[model samples]
Target: MPPCTTPNTTELVMIMDVESILHMKEGLGETSYSQNSSLQKKSTEAMKHFIIDSALAAYAFKTPEIFTIADLGCSSGINSLYLAEEIIKAIHERSRQLERLAPEFLVFLNDLPTNDFNAMFLSFPEFNMKFKAGIELQGGSAPSVYLAGIPGSFYSRLFPGNSLDFIYSCYSLHWLSQVPLGLLDSDCKPINKGNMYISNTSPPAVSLAYFKQFQKDFSLFLKSRSVELHFEGRIVILMLGRRTEDHSDKCTTVLWELLDQSLEIMVSQEIIDEEKVDAYNVPFYAPSAKEIKDEVHREGSFVIDCIQAYELSTSTGDPKEDARIISMAIRAIQESMISHHFGEAIIDTLFQIYSGLLSEFMVKEEIKSSHLLVILRKSC
Candidate 1:
């Protein structure tokens, strides 16, 4: 047989395909998503009460014998299972309060096809046992719970019409289905050069491109879920966002700016070419609350139940430790894209430089990320 072959970084970047390449770092290794996702877990914990309340509300709305739920962008980590268990427990407790039989649950765990599902599946046995033991302690009948992985992008349809009762997604919507095509010119050259994302120095067109992509992708998301959800089905989404309407706000772009600074350092040191840095642009966007509300209203499928803004500090009172933790967390999420774009050789050095930059920045200023919690009910 001929030797195996795969596309190179340049080839992949030229096409601007994110769905084919975007995935968190896999497995249980030191740099794995499972190891470095404490930041995400913190965000989830902060919103845990809202998540539980939303699940209960959905359960109360439709007491179906087989209650179906889906967690979109369920990356490989214990956090995914943790959220699932929370929903299951909330619905189970609500059934107990009503003195009625609990509904059998069908929990769908969804993510990109390249996600490390095997790593997630390996931990299910332990999760299931712990879940059952907890239910046994409460002295109630164990409701049947089933989980199956669905590998695909959420920008498209994932389920049959009127099949889902509830849906939950966290920290995943900021990623565009693909890098916005408007980022390129007629010559197919990157317009937002020397910056990995929307930045203070980027031109007006760059910000507009990012916003337009968000509008298109988010609208498609609502439309697809509208088809998949039962009437009045509920969705709880928590994702990275900004407090202001401006796309280049520091609250959202600081992390990417720091990463870009690190890449510039490498370019100055002649470790990587300047052109290489200029060619790369991150396929991510952090929207403002107003933007989200507008999109939901324009989509006309879901009525906004709640939309709130929250902040999570990336500080631990020690700048160095905070830098390490924050850099690791970002690496776990963005390494796949960065490595694919710049090659795997610079992974270690890049993050090391990033950590140092973050350390210095943290000592001068406290870094916090803004998040948006949106609860929508299918109304059309």
Candidate 2:
């Protein structure tokens, strides 16, 4: 092979397969997402009303013989399996209402190839046993529950035609399939300096590029699911989103802005390259409700059933504790990618600065993260 040359921003964004970095840092240990995902748990709880209702609509109205459910971006531990159980609860309740045996279930847990499937697989025995016991306690035979891990990106089709009844994804679709192309300026230099993602400082071009990429990726996502979903099938998506159409909105990218602040401090101390900071763009987007609705309409497959926005806050009156919790959560999600670029050496120092920045941010004002819950149906 030719001498390995470090790829520039343009080449890096193009050639980097998301599966290489899309996974949660693995396992059930402290550094793992399993231990530090309380924020995501809160998101699921807030969206529970929407999830159960949509899942029930699929079961009661469409009532497939072999009910299929998919939990896209099913990362490690309790949350991943938790969704399966909630889905089962929806199926069981509908079955009870109809006065019939619960339909057999084929549940697919989907994530990137590098995701910690073993953590989920290891939890299977308890997941199924407890679920079955719960059914018996209700004086009904256990519904046949089958589990499979579908390892791939959701931007593409992962199942056959009309194969799904209810599809669910939580806190995941914000990730783009790849970095948006053309982050360079008219001068062919990186425009988004010091920030890993969209911030108040980002140029108009950067915001437009990210939003357009989301429109493209999200449209493809809908189109792929459109083919896989049965008539009237329902999909419930709950993820971090922006309340405003403006991509540069502060609340939408709050955590990232803090992260940017951390890196900027490091650059000021000459710890990491200012140029490297400028070159790196995180592959994530927080779409507005209007953006999502427009994409669903443009895809012409899924009709919006409902859209709800909730506030996620880490403010606890005490700044240090808030920073610790938020930093741990951020470390779990982005450590792998950050390590890849900045090396493992800076991990500790980075999050120390990250925590300090977050603490300062909380002291200034309360931070309420915006999360959007969208329910859609396959157009008949």
Candidates in order, TM-scores: namely 0.95, 0.95
Clashing pairs in 1: none
What's the lDDT of the predicted structure labeled candidate 1? 0.88
Candidate 2 clash total? 0
Which parts of model 2 are misplaced by more than 4 Å?
1-15
CA-lDDT, candidates in order: 0.88, 0.85
lDDT of 2 by residue, 1-380 (tens): 44333446543753375567767878878878999999899879877878988888888876766889999999987788887788787788778888887888999999999999988899999989998898889887888889999999999999999899999999999999987776775566677878788887888878887888898899889999999998989999998898787787778887898898889899999999888778777789999888888898877887899987777777778988888888999999998878877778999999999988888878888888898999999886
**Compared with the true structure, what per-residue lDDT tens digits does model 1 show for residues 65-138?**
99898999999877989888988988988888898889999999999999999988888888888888889988
